[model samples]
Every structure is written in structure tokens, then in C-alpha cells.
Target: MEPNNDFEIFLVATPGLEAPLHAEAVEQGFADTKPVPGGVTCRGSWPEVWRANLCLRGANKVLVRLGGFPAVHLAQLDKRARKFPWAEFLRPDVPVKVEATSRKSRIYHAGAARQRIEVAITETLGAPVSSDAAVRVLLRIEKDLCTFSIDSSGEPLHKRGHKPAVAKAPMRETMAAMFLRECGFDGSEPVLDPMCGSGTFVIEAAEIALGLRPGRSRSFAFENLPSFDPNAWSSMRQQQPLAKPDVVFHGSDRNSGAIEASTKNADRAGVADFTMFQTRSVSDIKPPSDAAGLVIVNPPYGARIGDEKRLRSVYGSLGKVLQTKFKGWRIGIVTSNAGLARSTRLPLLPPGPIVDHGGTKIRLYQTGVLT
Candidate 1:
């Protein structure tokens, strides 16, 4: 069969959360979604790839798979690399970096494999390969099959280009987004992060609610690609809906510094006008004017926050506050320690799945009622 112009988009997520990421990709309009072990695969063009980078919140990075070919040895690898349409993706003036990883394949020497691919790209396309280049091309060899992909997103999408400072063990933007999706955030209702450390969850929630593109404020690696069409991208940008949201989004933290950070991040994301930040402990949390909304909390865990026993008490106190104050609201808690979460004493459904938070496995706990 002939190769199609379709680009394979890899939505990188925490290990074991590929299904959720795949569902998210489909929900965002990418038709064909296949769940991989550590990520999801979808087909699209360069524009769709760009849009995914802008819109996907649960993805760690967006990799554009260029092509795949069978290569058992260096000789086959070099020949296949030379045949790839390097000129179509890389410009002579733009420097490119080749990164390679090998597993269970004859191409054992990763450094040598990268050098061969780099030489092929430079010699065939007349483009200089530099280690410090802004444009990066990734090569993966598994079981004598080589897969090539271009890093469309320069920085990981989790960076979000807004958070300058983070509290101890802060939840990553991608993880927070996944938790929100698991909690059923459809961007229609209000979201609350009661223990909003640096405000990542609240900011991401507000951005989703307002239909703001996460990648709008950052530059992408694909912008330097040879086939990049600035005019088409501008047209796409112009066509994006600018509708404002009409729901209340609130975040509060016991630490004043965290509240300040949340406020700054929301402002930087241009959703500050729609989000409310306050320096209040979870014990003091009060529901916003809305009859029902989400209460998502990423509280201090044993790894980051010391004294698990005392923290359990804090969680118990939090449970009391939620049950007494907000009865009809939905509650979602992100925590690495399941026991700590159970300390809340709220009847929670079985956690959806485990996600990686800085190498620790975290799960979501939800209360049946908001209160």
C-alpha cells in the first residue's frame, strides 16, 4: 500500500493512561485513535497536529511521526534514513538535532545510530545537523523497525508557558488535565481547586472553560519546519472561537504564596477575569454562588509534605468541611497515597486509573455529593 499524507500524532501521557488520552484525542476531533501502551496514536495533517498541541490538555508532548521503515542493521538504517523526505520537513538554514533510542533491535549503539541518521539528513537535504538546534527529530528503533518522528512541540505541552514558580510537588498541567477529564470536566460548569498549589488545576480548568488554546502563548518547534505554512496557521488562528465563559471558576489555597502564584498564572493565561483566587484553607472553603460545581484538590502528600499521619488528619478535616458546607457539589482529589485519600472518609468510587506524578503513582478520589 502507498503511504498516505497522514501524520501519526502520539499523545504522550503518563504510563497506563493511554486510553483516557485516546478518548480525549477523539473528543477533540481526531477521528482514528488507537491506544498504545504509553500513549495514543491519531492521524492528521500538520494543521491538525498544530491544533492538537494547542488544544490537548492531557498530553505531555505531541510527536509527529514522519515515517517508519524496517531496518535490521546500520546499513539498512542509513539507506532508509537517506530515502526519507528530509528536505520536505527540514530547511537548509535551520539546524536539526537527531535523537535516537533503541530497544531489542540490532541497532544497539544509540549514538552511532543517531550519527548515521544525522549524516543522512545533512548529506541528502543539505541541512546542517547541530546538537543545540531548536528543531529536534526523534528516532526510535524497536525490534529491527525504525520509527521517525518530529518534535512539533518545542517544549513539552505541560509547560503551558505561564507557571514560573511551583510549590513542592506541584501537579503537572498534563496530569491535572487528565484528572479533570476523569472527573468529567466538560467546560460547561464551574471548577474549584480548594488546595490549589500554584493554581495549575484551576488555571487549566479556566482555560478549558473559556476555550483558550494552551499553546497559543508559546512557540512550537514545527514553526521552523520547511513545510510550515504561516498563512494557513494565521487563518486557523483567526477562525478560532472567542466566546467568553459564563460560569464561576474558583481556586483557594492555605498558602498565600500559592494563591498569588495561581492568580499570576491565571492572569498570564488570560483567564484571570474568569477565575477567582483566594488565600483560604480547605477547612474554610465556601461554595461559590453556583448551586453545584467541581471541587478538585491536590493536597500535600507524604512524598512532598512530611508527616503522613498528621496529613491524614488534615484530610479528615477536609472531608468534614466538604460534607458540612457543600453537599450537592462534586469533589475530586488527586493524591499519590490512597490511604491518605481514604482518610477523607467519603464514599468514593474505584479510582479510574493510576497516573505518574513525578515518578509516583497517583489516583483520583471523588465524593458522591459535592458537600
Candidate 2:
């Protein structure tokens, strides 16, 4: 495998939400876009990889495909790994972590494969192999072929670096952004979340509408790569100036603590002016008068033993409020229990794919404009 000037950028996606991620890559003007099972792959330069980390909201992580070759055994893999031009992508001073996965390959022992690559990087490139290294080199061996990639995002893109406050089972920023995309929000319309745990949905929506880069407040693994040009990256990052949002976003919760957390989070995100959070129950929620947009909520499903029954009243009351109000506004409800969503009696369309939220399986149920 030889390092080249051209390469593929793999945008790691949250499983079951590949469609929205794929759509996002295409919309963001990435080239040769294609969707795979766990992520989306596109072709670009190193700078483009940097841009993907900063811009794409739906991407969980960004990986740069280094190269690949065929290897039938451990000896062949070790020999090839050493000759793969580790210097082209890795520096001798920085540490790296090598991870390997094997399936349907002659080199079935992933641990041994990882050991070989770690030795190769250490001996050939003079780089230390640390378990806690931010720079990760991933090796995937399938059908006697080995492909290598570098994780350009050190921290998951969801961190966004600004949101320190979170609620129990708060939705990852990546997942929240995808759901907003699935709901057809293009940043021009207002968004509302009644049960906005830590205001994930509300903050994400405000960022999108205002053209704020998710990576603006964070650092990426690509900064340490051999090919990275700090001046060029700085120029690229500063080229796109922020824009003011035309419409305001809203988030409310019955818990006063949740409201306080959301307010602090929104202010830290620099979207407090364009967004609002308040301590209010679902039944008291009211739509803004100016614009009709999407209402999205990630409510608790109470999937544990005897928990669903207790949550029925919450869903029922939420439905009553939205049905009578919020005309012409789209709605999306994310919950694990289909029974709980049905109790709302809102005209929900077919469910989206089952997504892994922490450990529980959840799906998004949407509706046409509420009549």
C-alpha cells in the first residue's frame, strides 16, 4: 500500500442513519459520494478531510483511507506494513495506536496482526506505540486484503467541545443533527424540542441555521499528521465566516434543572440569542407565531420492566398539546417503545430505521404538517 496525494475520506456514521449522513455529504459538496453500511466514503485531499471534520454535522468521525494491499499471512502483512511509507502519514516524534480487525481473511488473528503493525510503526518510522495515542491507524483485513486508515477526528465529532452540560441519556450531537436533517430542516426554519435534554436538538438546530462549524471549537487528529499545513488549515477555517440565523429555535422542559442546563449550554454555543430554553411542561408548549417548522423530541421510552405504563400519560399529554396547536408544523418523536408513541394518537408516518441509542433500540416516528 503506497501513500498517495489522492485518497478516500470515510465519514463514520451512526448506524441505521446512513441515509441522512450520505445526504449530508452530497449536500455539502463532497465528491464521488457513496454510502456503505457503517458510514459514507468520498474522495478528497487532506484539506478536504479537514473540512469534513469541521463542517459535516451528520458525521460521527472522519477517517482518511491511507492505502490497502493483499496479504495472505502474518509475515506478508508485517513485510508490507513496514514498506507502506509510514513516514508519509506519520511523524517519528508523535505516538500512534494501531488497531486491526480481521474477517474472512487468512490472517485471522487480529491481535498478532496489530502487533506486527505496531512493531512496523515503532521500528520503521521510529514512532512510539501508545495505547492512549490520539492518532489511530486502523487495519481492516477481509478476504486476504488489508486496508489502512487514519482517524482524523481524535475526539468523536459529537463532542463539539462546547457542550459540557448533558442530561441523562442525552442524544449524541451527531444523531441529533441527522434526525433534524431527516425532518427536512435546512436551517431556515425554526425548531422546537419540548423535552430537550440538555438542549441537544435545540443547540444543533441553531448551529446549523447559523452556519456554525461543529469543529470550530475543537481540535482534530489531522493536525498532527505529516502532511498537515497549519497555515493552510488556519486559512481554510477562517475563510468561512459565521452568519446570523433568521429564525429563532426553542427548547423547553418541565424540569427546572434541565432548563438551567440548556440555557448555559446554549450560551456557551453562542446561540443563546437565536435560541431559547424555559421551564415549562409539554401541555403548556406553544408554537411561535411567525414561522412553521419542525418539532423534534427524544422522549424517554421507559423500556425497562413496568416502566412503559408510567410514561403513557406523558406521551398522551404531549400529543394533546401538539394536535390542538402547532398546525402546519412537522413533528418527529424518537422513542424506544412503539406503544408509547402510538398512545399519542398523532398521525405518525412509518417508523425510520431502528437506531442504537446507548444500548436501547429506538426509532424516529414522523408526521406530516399537523392539521
lDDT of 1: 0.83
Model 2 alpha-carbon miss at residue 237, Å: 1.0
TM-score of candidate 1 relative to the true fold: 0.95
Query: How does model 2 score by TM-score?
Result: 0.97
- Tens digits of lDDT, candidate 1, 15-130: 75677688888888885888888888888888888888878888888898888798988988999889987877789889999999999999899999999999998899988888
User: Who wins the lDDT comparison?
Assistant: 2
Could you give candidate 2's per-residue lDDT for residues 1-371 as a string of tens digits? 44466789899999898999999999989999999999999998898899999899989999999988999999999899888888989999999999999999999999999999999999998999999999999999999989999999999999999998888778999999999998888898989999997999999999998888888889999998889999999998897667887799999999988989999999999999999888888999999646899999988878633477779998999998999998899999999889999999999999999987768888999999988
Task: Go through the candidates in order and give each one's C-alpha lDDT.
Answer: 0.83, 0.91
For each predicted model, how many residue pairs clash, with residues at least 3 apart or on different chains?
5, 0
Model 1 clash number = 5
Model 2 residue runs over 4 Å out of place are 1-3, 304-306
